[model samples]
Target: MLVDLHSHTIFSDGRSTHAEMVEAAIAKGIGIYGIADHLCFHDNPWTTRLDQFEEMRSTFANLKANTTSAKILFGMEVDYVRGCENRVLRLKEENHWDYIIGSVHYIGDWNIDSNAADWEGKDVDATYTKYLELLEEMVDTKLYNIVAHLDLPKKYGHFTDIDFTDRYRAIGEKILANNMAFEMNTAGRIKICNEFYPRRDIVELYHQLGVDVTLGSDAHHRNNVGQFFDEAVALLKEVGYSRICYFEEGQKRYLPL
Candidate 1:
């Protein structure tokens, strides 16, 4: 069964509405699909607007009520910002989300993943170090169920010079310690990264660590709901993953490969 729980809508940086995405997922034969729009600090360029956030909530309710062919879950992809744990916790309570995908999109106001060309003066090593630090903290807080796009900074060919294997190992350990799922994000297949998030070697490490795995297209468009999933599954199988996970109402379920 194809179960995907990481995607966005027009409410955030995505291109399709919830209805269009549902149609796409159904066509792809997905067993369970979720709409996980960005619910980050209001300052980010891709964050959902206040009014759109409310509208999407209603859309989620309607979709959940109406969807019968496939399970529809309401999820949030939140950006972890230091010193904003209270806000994040409050938002979690307010949303009553089915699952939350925690990600680090910013490091001290330097939006590393926002653009690659703009990274002229940024210290590549220092930047990723800070990201991993925040990731460790996020895991410790137990504020999210899945870690979105692990090692996303490698996207856009920006980390070619940096070797963050140790950092990634630490991040993997934290995810395992905190009982969070490691997301296998297929969006990287289309991004300049030219591979999945966490890379194959890192994924193998996670498999060795016995971390629970989850897959996400990170699709922003309707047509992208389950894109690149076959390749992702093949990679997972090669890495020795026998089961994959999906979440519903914050509960994790494992599906055999």
Candidate 2:
């Protein structure tokens, strides 16, 4: 079964509507498609407004009631801001989501993935260090079902000479301890990084550490639904992963690769 669990719609930064993305997923032969639009309090254009939350839920409900070709999951990609634990917890309590993808898009109000211009004059090593620190904290919250776009700070080709292998392994171990799944986000391949999120070596490391994974295209447009997934599956199998995971009402389940 082909499952692409992370994607967006007009409710966030995506160009496609929910229905349009579903159609594209069906055409791409996805057996389980999840709509995980952004949920953030950052007041950015990409963040879904608080007022639209109910609409998103209702629309997804309508879709779930009508669509049958593929199993549709209601999800959200929440930004992991340092001082916003209460907000995240409250949102989690209010929504009945199949999965919640925790992403570190910001480091103390500095948007990491917003654009390359924001990266100017930044200390590469410090930035990487901070990103990892936030990731560790996000895992400790024990509030997320999946980690979205691991190593997202590399989105703009910024490099740090410092080796963070040990730190990454610690985080991987924490993720496993928390029973959170790692996400192999394919959107990075289309970005300037020209690679998948977490990188192949990280994927291999996670596999060796016994961290289960799930696939996500991070598609913003309908055409990109399930994009590069074939490559993702091949890479996972090459790394000794014979199966991938999905979620149902927040419970993790596996499928053969």
Candidate 3:
């Protein structure tokens, strides 16, 4: 059975409604489907509002109650921006979400969705360094169940010249120290990079560091629900990973891969 832990719905920037996303997962025979809409500061356009959260929660509850074959889990993909601890804590305290995926979608003064031409040419090493700094902060805050797409700056195409081994080792150490699971996100294959997020080298390094791993599609549409999931499982098995992590009531649990 396959489990996809990172997905979005119309509550954020995704194209599909929550029910459509869930139904598609069921059709694909996915064992567990987690809905993780974007969560960011109120000023961000993609930030999921409280009403949207309630609507998604209602949808998940109904699906869980009515569906016997598949399990639908409610989660959020929160951007780890500066000064986000209180919001993270509040969301966890107030909601009965199954998991939270913390990601660094913005740097010191740059956002991932920016279209400025020069942004693409920025130094890959420096950008990754800054991203790692933010990742360390995310781990220190202890506000999430998993770290989504550990090496996201590679999506910008500037990291082709950079060697990520040492850097990934450092980041993997921090993740292990915090007992946080690192996600092998397949969304990159369909999105900007046309490759798996974090790539293979990073995944092997994480395995070497003894860091637990999780698989996520980061799916924004119904067709992409389980994109590259079988390949992801194969890669995990190759790296000696026997299980993937899941979240229940804010705690992490291992499930057979």
Candidate 4:
């Protein structure tokens, strides 16, 4: 059984529509799929109002109420902005979703994950330190079920000399403490880093910490719905993961791999 729980559509930065995403998931033989679109506070120059949130809720509710396609769930890939947890929480509270994916995309109203120029003239070490700190804080918020793209700081291939073991260990501990799962988001395979979201060592650490595991493609287009999923599954197996998790009606369930 194929499980892909992270994807986007025209709702956010994705390139496909909701119908297109469903068709692509069915085409890929995915038994379980999730439409986890972006939900953030920092405008990034784009703002989603309460009304828009309700509209998104209607789409999710309608999909659940009316879809005859493969098993699908509605979720939001919410960004964790430092010092704005309460505001972000309020924004997310407007909707009753199947699940929530907490991610750290900003450090202080600054988008550091994508666009090479974002890293230009920036201190990679300080940025990474703050990113990890915010990641730990985001998990501490305990407002989300899963953490998306664990190594987002590396999304644009920014690496510093700082040791990641302590930082990742702390982050992993927090995720475990909060009962949040992190997925092997394969979208990184297409990024400059050209690796999974977290890379292998971090996955290994999570397994050692007994953290729950899930999977995603972070697909923005229909064709990429289940892109590189097989590789992610194999990588999980190699890392000692025996089952993958999914959500249904806001409840977490696992399927043996």
Whole-model lDDT, model 4: 0.83
Tell me the whole-model lDDT of each prediction, alpha carbons only.
0.86, 0.92, 0.82, 0.83
Best model number under TM-score: 2
Q: Least lDDT summed over 10 consecutive residues: which range in candidate 1?
A: 48-57
Which pairs clash in the backbone of model 3?
none
TM-score of 1: 0.95
| Cα error of candidate 2 at position 52, Å | 0.4
Q: Give lDDT tens digits, candidate 4, residues 1-257.
A: 88889998877888888888988898888988898888777765333444567678777777777767578788888887766677666765667677888888887868886578878888888988888888888888888889888888887888677888988988888887876788889999999889998889899999999988898999989989888888888889998999988877567799998
Alpha carbon lDDT of residue 241, candidate 4? 93
lDDT per residue, candidate 2, 68-170, as tens digits? Answer: 9999999999988877789988887788889999999888889989989999988888999999999899999998999998899889998778888999899
Query: What TM-score does each of the candidates earn?
Result: 0.95, 0.98, 0.92, 0.94
Ranking by lDDT: 2, 1, 4, 3
Backbone clashes (count) for model 1: 0
RMSD of 1: 1.5
Q: Write the per-residue lDDT of candidate 3 for residues 1-257, one digit (tens) a residue.
A: 88888888888888998888888888888888888899877466677887766777778789878877778888888888779799789887777888889889888657754454647557766878788889878877877888998878767555656665786787788878877788889988865667898888788888888999887888889999988888999999998899988777777788887
- After TM-score superposition, what is the CA distance of residue 68 in candidate 4 from its true location, in Å? 3.2
| Window of ten residues with lowest summed lDDT in model 4 | 43-52
RMSD of each: 1.5, 0.9, 1.8, 1.7
Better of 1 and 3 by lDDT: 1
